[model samples]
Target: MQKNSSSIKSSTDILKQAIQFIGQHNITAIPINYTVSYEYCRGHHVLLRQAIDQAIVNKQPITNEAIQGWFDAFLLGYDLSELNKSHLDLNNIVDQLASTTTQAEEDVNQYDTSLKECKDELNETLDTSSLSSIVSSLLTSTTAMQIAMEQMKQQITASQCEIASLQDRLALVTIEAVTDPLTGLANRKGLSMAINESLSTALQSKNYPCLLLLDIDYFKKINDSFGHLVGDKAIKILADTLKKQLKGKDTAARYGGEEFAILLPETDLQNAWKVGENIRRVVESLRITRSNNHEEVFRMTISIGIARYQANQSINDLIELADNALYQSKNTGRNRVTIFETKL
Candidate 1:
């Protein structure tokens, strides 16, 4: 056994119940058991198992309170922590695990910042150096002063390295801006750029893409019933499902709270319907665990609205069409798919 070997085993064993529940169900689950057992349970059962198994390999012990805390933090998807810990917090032991992850990320960021600052200061020093500046100005007069020519060449080479360092830092910042801090997935801005580009291509090629808009049903009710903590688990489960169904030329966006949108490129109404039906089935079939310490399974029914792209309109038009269709699904009785048509 290794460091947290026993604890990790306990975690894996706990997830076993969740895995069994997912296996028994033909579809995926919502409000997934995002505790220790399902650490990486988003996306699918295969993912859930892999996450738990890796944690077990690390041999870490996870307390029940820590297990509960993980759900509160990760699945609940809260952007800001009240930085609050309760007096009866049953999760203090797992605090080390989360802190470790946070510290690692913080360290990497600090390193990058320090490295860039060092390079910037170096450049400033070189720029202000009388020797380098004079050498450059007098380079054309090199024959008049060969010594000066050689020194300028060296300064230029040194400056090139400093500039390269700056360029690298700029790239890192750009990537960080478009990434989801937790999941490492594209953020709303990145998703928007991608969708816009895809729409343009579809219009130019005279091919249509399907846009599906969906929201968790009675989400507010769930939150009110079982605290915001458990409500977060439900959101993560849905996010996982969206990720699983995504493919090349397909994009999924958070589309605001409890709501998600997907864009499928060069996919027509029939194929889009097939895809929509698949999503509907997967969501309805997801077996999610609830707030009770005991096993509680849940299935979510999604109301989806689909819209096709037209050269005459903008991306917003497509989104609105999909929303209308989704509204129709909800009206007809939630947990179904509706396609948009100008007629209604």
Candidate 2:
């Protein structure tokens, strides 16, 4: 009881200190910022603490973007302890199955030996009493064998169910690992995997894929004007618009804060530009209302850059080309699509 009380007190103290730190730094009290601050106050995450301290020493403002980056880099993903426990449970189930099978095999062998002895006894001259005893022994052996077989069958069925359940749990974990909690879209890791697979398929089919890198224009301004919550809502809106415009084979992912990536399989430069334009138009048309007041509304837009994959080009190279095109769109004007060209 004393230990529990101490833990509660420590947690409360950390929360208080985190709130104070946020107030001192003028940081937004968003969930991510609060979590990072709390962890920093706890002093258990050494790397996170070091990063925070380094930022302070450098006199850099701890912005929401920086906090989110830290959270993604350090605190994201499923817990390792839970994953380890799942693996251990699976192993135990497998061992139990193996032991059950071994027992069943031993029972079968014993039953086989009993049948052999009964057969040998039948071959010898025997009285009625002897024959009766032999028959009874055979019946008992057969009954035991049938029971063992049934037990083995039931055990195997149970093991299969356990294996199926574990597979389902692991599948869910895999999806969660690659998914962004906010937008219901793929995260950076998922995007990376999709890019690799698309590139590989393109290589085999001799058809190239197109990559699009998109960024919300002046996202920080939106965050500052409205708030992080509204900023997130705009992101979700953009994500939904992108999803609506994509083909079945296309992969869309949240690349990072306020940035999104789309991989278009077997798409040429012209079609990729058209897709980008459609998305840009859709995003530009969206007017989000502030949650606090229905009378207040704001608009957002996205800039897109497109690049077609070339033979023998790495994933990074393709992304760089797309990013360059995206930069051109951002530089000349916002809410436009730019295609990568050698001249640019």
Candidate 3:
């Protein structure tokens, strides 16, 4: 009991320190669970600790973007461990079910053999004691068989319930796996999945898909000027703008840092360019105010690059083209959209 109490106190102390560390760095992304879990984790804990330390050493406020970058690099798929544990449990249940089935089969075979023996004994001799003994043996065998079957049925039902539970957990884990926790937009992995599905639909319908790459113009300046909290708000504002502009089948994802991506299904280059222009204009229209003073702080803008998918083209190739076009927008001027021109 004393040992357990000491361990709990130690864990509590570590969690408190972790929370203080997050506070010292001005990080809003560190959830309570993450802080608590970091107390127990080794590799990921060290990674995050080093990142926070570096930010402190550099006198940089730990922005959500920095945390997200670390997550993408060091902790991308760590959240799925629980899901994996669920799967392992499900496998174990299945194995138990199989074992129960084997036991039931053996019981059935034993009952069958006992019944045949009783029939043979009754036919050979009609003595009262022998007949009584055979009848008792038959009744015992039947009862044992029934019990085995009942146990097997119960095991199967329990296994089914457990499997259903694991599946639900897996679905949730899948969503969290591909989603960006901060902006509620899809992450890079989710973006890739969406793009691949869109490309497949395009191939089947002969309608080309389009990709748009967007970057928040002068985002670092925003962080330096206001603070990371306001910078987070600015990023969220852009995300909201992108979400509003997307169609039913369109996918918008955070493509790391100030970069975002959109996969538009069944769209050509011209329409995609127009969509990018709309997003650019809407973002430029946003005015963020300082929370403390209620004074208008600044407006935001984004640069976008648009490219239509070609037949037999890879997602990376499409993104590269769009990325180059996005740079064109950045080079010429901010708050504009550029279409990727195909090189002959």
Candidate 4:
């Protein structure tokens, strides 16, 4: 997931182009549509660009469904259909190898029988013609066995290489499925997987685990004032800051939109509060300058809510508690931390 960068003016220009494209096509200005159009304008995804270009050249109507299809096929890690096709191909290769191996085994058995016959013939009293025929038969059997073995070897080698390639692609697809393209953080699905694993381990080890939900204060205002590109930069900044502040064992994710979630293993409520407070202060101190006008600098703040896991608690319940505390923080002030207290 390499991020694409451009100057502020250039980004704004691209944004305008994207909007114009969407308008011309009579497509709705949804987030996905905007994203695909922006990427097309940037020419980042070659296949995506080509699809759009071809549609335009052929006078095909650009529809939302078409854009979404392209996004899923190209922008996303890999297409599900393509993945299934790869699996079918892998199965076919395996089947071919199996057949080849069976053929080779049969060839070896046949060659052995030929040798036995030749031995029996040699054991008997035979003339020059009889001996010559036996020798020729042996040569033919040996050659056929050699050719079968060679074919098997080549098939095995080819299959091995193909399987390795498929494995690599599957690994990449798995990563991309869980990763957020914009901030390079774990997406919600990844976060949930991490939570499940942590919860299972914590339940066994009796270790404390805490979840923190953070939301950028006035995030929509930032988007409205500067634009979505700048807003995206802000989110990336927060994500990077979280990565720096947290330990390797902790899991950080872009929960959704301007909100983020952090899972801390072996951490109690008190320690979680400290972590949340530290992040709040650090983000408050950050100065984000407008890319177009450096003189116009602004600061961003985040509100965090924390909830520690309890015995027999579900993941959804824990997240809800954290969300409640987050609502408390938002209601109290724009930037603060709140810890959820369970009523005994």
- Measured by lDDT, the strongest candidate is 2
Candidate 3 residue spans exceeding 4 A from truth:
1-127, 150-154, 157-165, 290-295
Give Cα-based local distance difference scores for all models: 0.62, 0.83, 0.76, 0.82
Top candidate by TM-score = 4
User: Per-residue lDDT tens digits of candidate 4, residues 1-344?
Assistant: 01221233354455457657877899765445666787788787898899999999999888878888988887875323333433454555566667668878888888899999899999995789999999999889888888888888997997788667656654655566678888889998789889988988899989969999999999999999888988988999999999999996899999999999999998999999999999999999998876776754469999899999989888999999999999999999869999999888
Q: Order of all candidates by TM-score, from best down to worst?
A: 4, 2, 3, 1
Q: Where is model 4 poorest over a 10-residue stretch in terms of lDDT? A: 1-10
- State TM-scores per candidate: 0.52, 0.68, 0.67, 0.72
Q: Which stretches of candidate 1 lie over 4 Å from their true place?
A: 1-169, 182-185, 290-294
lDDT for model 2, on a 0 to 1 scale?
0.83
Report how far residue 223 has shifted in candidate 4, in Å: 0.3
Count of clashing residue pairs in every prediction: 12, 0, 0, 0
- Could you give the C-alpha RMSD of every candidate to the true structure, in order shown? 20.4, 11.6, 9.9, 12.1
Instruction: Give me the displacement of residue 164 in model 4, in angstroms.
Output: 3.2
Candidate 1, residues 117-214: lDDT per residue as tens digits? 55566666765575465455444343433444355455456445534542443344456545554444566666677777886777678887788888
Question: Lowest summed lDDT over 10 consecutive residues: which window, candidate 3?
Answer: 35-44
- Give candidate 2's TM-score: 0.68
